[model samples]
Target: MATPRIESHAFPRSWKDLIGHERIRSTLSSAIAKRRLGGSLLFVGPPGVGKTAAALLLAQTVLCRRQSAAEMNPCGQCPDCAQVRAATHPDLIQVSKPQDKSLIPLELLIGPVEARLQEGFCHDVHLRPMQGERKVAILHDADFLNEEGANCLLKTLEEPPANAVIILIGTSEQRQLPTIRSRCQTMRFTSPTGVEGRELLRQHIQRLTEAGQSPPSLADAELDEAIELAAGDLQVATRLASGQSNEIRGKLLTQLSASVPDPMIIARCINSHLDEISKKEAPLRRAGLRDLCSIAVQYYRGELREAARQGRYNGADARRLDRTLRVFREIDRSANLNALVDCYAADLSLAITGDRGSIG
Candidate 1:
């Protein structure tokens, strides 16, 4: 498969180019200036924030031969900086969950157990840097690190190579093992502000123009609605700006407002719409699930407000709504859209009608 070519300037090459997390950049700069950078660090945040970008920028800066610690910037012209940007630097390593499987396999971290620790991420980090002053290994799917994998990494986290930095990136701290979390310095990232979200959307639009691709047909209130719906996640905002959200929202409003809710009917309706989204693999499939779930939540929130206005709010109704939300949360964790949709649809029916319901 061909790699997507990002317009040069659209790719985040420095801290300044990253979309959000202003304080994270400042704090990292201070650490570099004081030489207090931790050997092991964990970046915890929601998806589409600047965690990965910040990690890459910091890695490039750390490996830049021409930059002083006080400078805290990569000399972009250096061989080290160029290679890092192209992801070809020998000293920079990145590992993520493979598509075929759900978890980050243990071997990807420390090599096959039979290798006797002779090769792998852990073993490679122990060796001297092949090109730069230090090695930077980024574990991208830290949330999927199993017990054995986390244990395999513990030693390195405790006493890392003299000039190595190991950074774990994950969505939430709670998803990581306590033992692993305790040893690493943690950086928490938050969603961008409303203004920042709009700016990020515009930047993406500009990139489309530069790439000679027509931008999505959305403007003014519709664009703002997408930005607000995205809640500061740039990737989600991009999808929303493409007008997918409006289509999904329209379907959700009609079905959720039906006088006689039918879980099976609603489930089939959603399943059909999502099936038409594209045969384009996992990420799109996963995004469709997320968008549907978000619409359901948003729709119910409005219903809750109206019910309260009519003095019809009650504990049982609230509990049913909570159950519906929990199903969405589970969908995120498991990434199993099919398994949860029926249950979610049933819960939504119950929540709306205050009656027991099940998808037949």
Candidate 2:
């Protein structure tokens, strides 16, 4: 159980304070006034687009006992409101996909949730809020819920326990479970445009400077770098400002320029750059997956261009190009289900070290 959220200096107070996703906030706010709130809301959006934060706000709004119908928002001053804001409210159950691994098995969710349901929420967690009236569960990175995990969630969604509400946060529709999608009240968030993305990065830079942790004269140029790396994820951008150092652009360019001796060599060159990526498995693998997927798109685009050299493109080449385009279009797709990076490594090794294609 996380700590009850408060309006302390550490926490954000208003929906507008979030960097992106105004439409999402508006929908959630509107829902609060309706007689029947979405018991299960699926927040589908790019990471750092305020999904989880919105979930917390919704939890606060629903649990606030003294809020007026007009505002339909929590009085950040109330104890319940503060607790939920602090992430310490006992009834506010938060579940995240296992960060250590690529996927979350439904089994993990089943036992604990069932046990909690049987015990009537309080037994599973202690220090229930003295003020809040209901239970809220936030399932973050819900797209990683594998078959069993999603089924467990589906069961709960089908028959929600009294006074319990569930919010599922996912990156994209492709990542989400279809049945889960059908069941929940859906809300979608798009990546902020380049301009919005830059503004968000600037805000993070300002906040860090205001904190005195970073020097006031630090180059603001890195703000754009942070935005590009985050791909418009406000959370990622802020995290970068707080010290999550991403690879410098030059290194990535160097890696991409492997000895492209031939068709097979091109693949090997790619693998050579990524060889050590797998070694740093646990903590960095998630980022590795994102990078690998993005790189694959780049590789395919290059291949399609090469294929175009064969003035009359064949059907096979066109199909591969089409698949590549699909992957590019769905930036929010979870690469957890695929083994492309591993396969790329193997194929590249076969080309360079084995009998397949060769490159010096």
Candidate 3:
């Protein structure tokens, strides 16, 4: 196996440090406490949620040298806990997609599809732990597993190594191969909202402070603005803690509230701002588009509600709003940002003036 340098500087010290995911924490704690922990686990959830963090916590709990039968929590002070935290535990094998490639290569698991027991994560997992009682293999970015790579893991999943746990981290069960999903116990994570979201944000801010890092000075309203734009996403909320969210939200609101909104101008402004946010990366650009689309939807929904309150409801307004959402979905899936921008501009024009011919 690759014996790269490992450190716990990036991870939380204990499960309690993980924000939100109360149900996930309880279920995992019970499993650990009852000694009913399965050998294969699939953590499925949206981005920025604590799925990977939960998986790591489970590893820490299993490898903790100081816990008793009555306790399921990691002591965060034991040598084993420190090793696991630092990712230096000989029993723990963590694998993920290489930075340059999109998919987790089959070679990472097996030397070749035809090879029988060559060196790889699968082979390494089967070997007995060098230090701890149990081996824990954490495979991150499991969504990027190709058919061949995933199939190679089936045999091990079906008949796992004794005293070992294999945790696969993915965004959704649907994205994983059926065979892989069937062989593993699945846990779904949901993004926290409302009080939960706010609490999570507060905890993260506290962590930053504890780390001796100074975040941008933000007022209560500015903090709330970031949280509101984040829509219960902790990672997004944390990124917004730097005050970038306010700038983006302001631009979006200004465009929406323009007395005579020009679709071309609005689209250009949005694309320009998103380009800055994304730094020209296609994936980040798409994410920026999605965020802008969410803001636009909120604006249109408010307009529709206002019209209803005034007893001047227009079916066309609702229709345009729905179309804007559809366009957002399309933009998210499309690769050609330029073409998507044109389509988005046209759609926004339709919403603004009810004229499809306003922009080509």
In terms of lDDT, which candidate is strongest? 1
lDDT of 3 by residue, 1-360 (tens): 333343464556777777777788788778767887768999987666777777777888888878852365789898888887777888888888775566787778886557756778889888987876888999988888989899989998988987889999987898899999999999888776656666666665655564567645566665566555555455556656654445667766776665445678777777887778876677677667766665666677778889889999766557556766666435433437777677666655566432344221
In the range 1-360, model 2's lDDT, one tens digit per residue, is 222232344334666666567777666667556755646778888665657667777777777778852374567787777777767765677766544455664434654545634342223323333445567877776777777667656666766655667788887877787888888888887766556666655555565565546533334566555554555555555555444334432343343344332334434443444444554453354444344334444554555567678765444334433443343323233343234443434433233322223211
**lDDT by residue (tens digit), candidate 1, 238-352:** 6667766565577666776775467887788777767877655655677776766555555566678788999887544465556655754465456467766776777667664
State TM-scores per candidate: 0.85, 0.67, 0.74
Better of 2 and 3 by lDDT: 3
Candidate 1 clashing pairs, residues 3+ apart or interchain:
none
For candidate 3, the lDDT comes to: 0.72
lDDT of each: 0.73, 0.56, 0.72
For all the candidates, what are their Cα RMSDs to the real structure? 4.3, 7.1, 5.6
Worst 10 residues of 2 by lDDT: 351-360
Q: Over all chains combined, what TM-score does candidate 2 have?
A: 0.67
Q: Find the number of clashing residue pairs for candidate 3.
A: 0
Q: Model 2 clash tally?
A: 16
| For model 1, the run of ten residues with the poorest summed lDDT | 1-10
Give per-candidate clash totals: 0, 16, 0
